[model samples]
Target: MTPLLDVRELVVRYGDFTAVDRVSFPVGAGETLALNGPSGCGKSSTALAVLQLRRPDAGEVLFEGRELTTLTERELRPIRPRMQPVFQDPYGSLSPRHRIRDAVAEPLKVQGRWNDTDGPTRVAELLDRVGLDPSYGDRHPHELSGGQCQRAGIARALASEPRLLVLDEPVSALDPSVRAGVLNLLADLQDDLGLGYLFICHDRAVVRHFADRAIEMREGRVTSG
Candidate 1:
């Protein structure tokens, strides 16, 4: 069966520096593939390249069967909705001005569901789906705790009905005590939504807990998995 995301000998460079070198991996449907390594090991670079946020110097970042590397912005727009990211800082990811509900609803609106009669209901459902109370939808990012903010970020990412989530240091910013809940929430999400994850992190312990399989990187190359 075709994998949901396939990274084939991907090479990403920054002038004199090679951020990612011929890295290859496959994330099957509903699986968590952890990219584990120390800082500057190219794990994050690989994730960004897959999202087409960074253009790779060589190789392919294939989604399902589509070659994303060469897709124009116009060509990539439709596919973008199927892949979403949750970054390191939940507070930085959310807008201070927008309420949680508005933030979650933005994706749906952009996807042309703006006029749908069930828009509000759908937003509420996503909030609940991410383990946030529907009432929290009225709150701003500032009013929520780190865990709650992260949950809201997850809710926003799911608003697009993405099949894969590029979770880059998802639980790192939260308190250690709350980390388990957030991680458990992610596990539950994968089971319920059948979501594939490109889980990037520096901590091997967290990766062991969250990911089904992992690959190690060093100096922009895959060292082991």
Candidate 2:
């Protein structure tokens, strides 16, 4: 079967320094593919390149069979909603000034899908889907616990109705006690939605248990799998 996401010969650079060099991987639908490595091992760099947030200097990022690297920013706008990101810092991922509901609703509004009649209901459903109470939507990021904030972030990502999620150390910032819950939530989401995940993580134990398959990276190179 064709992979949901395919990256081949990927390279990312910062001035004279190369962060990711000639890396490649494929993530299938409803599968979790972990980029496992230590800090500065280029896992995050690969995520950015795949999202086209930082365009790759070399290689191909094929998402649903379309090449993303060659697309202009405007051309990528519509596609962006279909592949969302959930970052490590939950509180930081959300706007401190905005209520949780607003943050979750922003994606739909931006995509021109919001209708006053049902938009509020959709946001509530997303929050509930991520295991957050709809009432929590009235609160700001700072008002919620770390795990709650992260759930809110997931709700925001789901609002985009993404097919693939680029999770950049998504559970690393939360307390260990809360990590499993978030991981389990992600697993359930994948099972229910058939979503693909590019899970970037440093903890081998977590990757081993969470990922369907994993690629090990070191100093910008794929060292093992």
Candidate 3:
């Protein structure tokens, strides 16, 4: 069966510097794949390339059997909802001025699916889904703890009902105690929602606990483990 997401010979370059060098991988439905490596090993670049946040100089990114590289930004817009990202820095990813409801609903709004009446209700549901109370929706990122902010980010990512979620060091910044809770939340979300995850991190222990399979990267190339 074809994988839900496929990356073949992905090479990302910034001028003369090669960030990701011909790395290839596949992620199937409901499967969690971890990309592990030290800093500047292209793990984040690989994720960005898949999300099309960073255009690859060379390679093929296929999502649900369609080649994303060939699609124009306008064409890729609809597919964006099917793929979402949760960045490492929860504090930076969220807007300090916007309330949790607005932050969570931003994706839907950008997709032009926001409703004046139902948007808040849906936002509340998502906040609840991510382990935050509906009342937290009134709070801004600054008012929440690190874990809560990350939960908000996760809620925002899920707002689109994405089939595949790319989590770039989703729990790396949190305290050890808080990390497990967030990790458990992710696992529960995956099992309950059947969401596929591309969990990127350098921490082997976290990756082993969170991912079904782990791929190691070194110097922009996928290392054989």
RMSD vs true structure, all candidates: 0.9, 0.6, 0.9
Q: Tens digit of lDDT per residue, candidate 1, span 45-131?
A: 899999999989999988988889998999999999899999999999999999999999999988897766899999899999888
lDDT of each: 0.94, 0.96, 0.94
- Poorest stretch of ten by lDDT in candidate 1: 108-117
TM-score per candidate, chains pooled: 0.98, 0.99, 0.98
Give the C-alpha lDDT of model 3. 0.94
Top candidate on TM-score is 2
Tens digits of per-residue lDDT for model 3 on 8-103?
999998889998999999999899999999999999999999999999989999999999998999999899999999999999999998998899
lDDT (Cα, 0-100) at 211 in candidate 2: 96
Clashing pairs in 3: none
Candidate 2: where are CA atoms >4 Å away?
Answer: none
Q: How close is candidate 3 to the true structure, as a TM-score?
A: 0.98
- Clash pairs detected, candidate 1: none
lDDT of 2 at 148: 97
lDDT-better candidate, 1 vs 3: 3
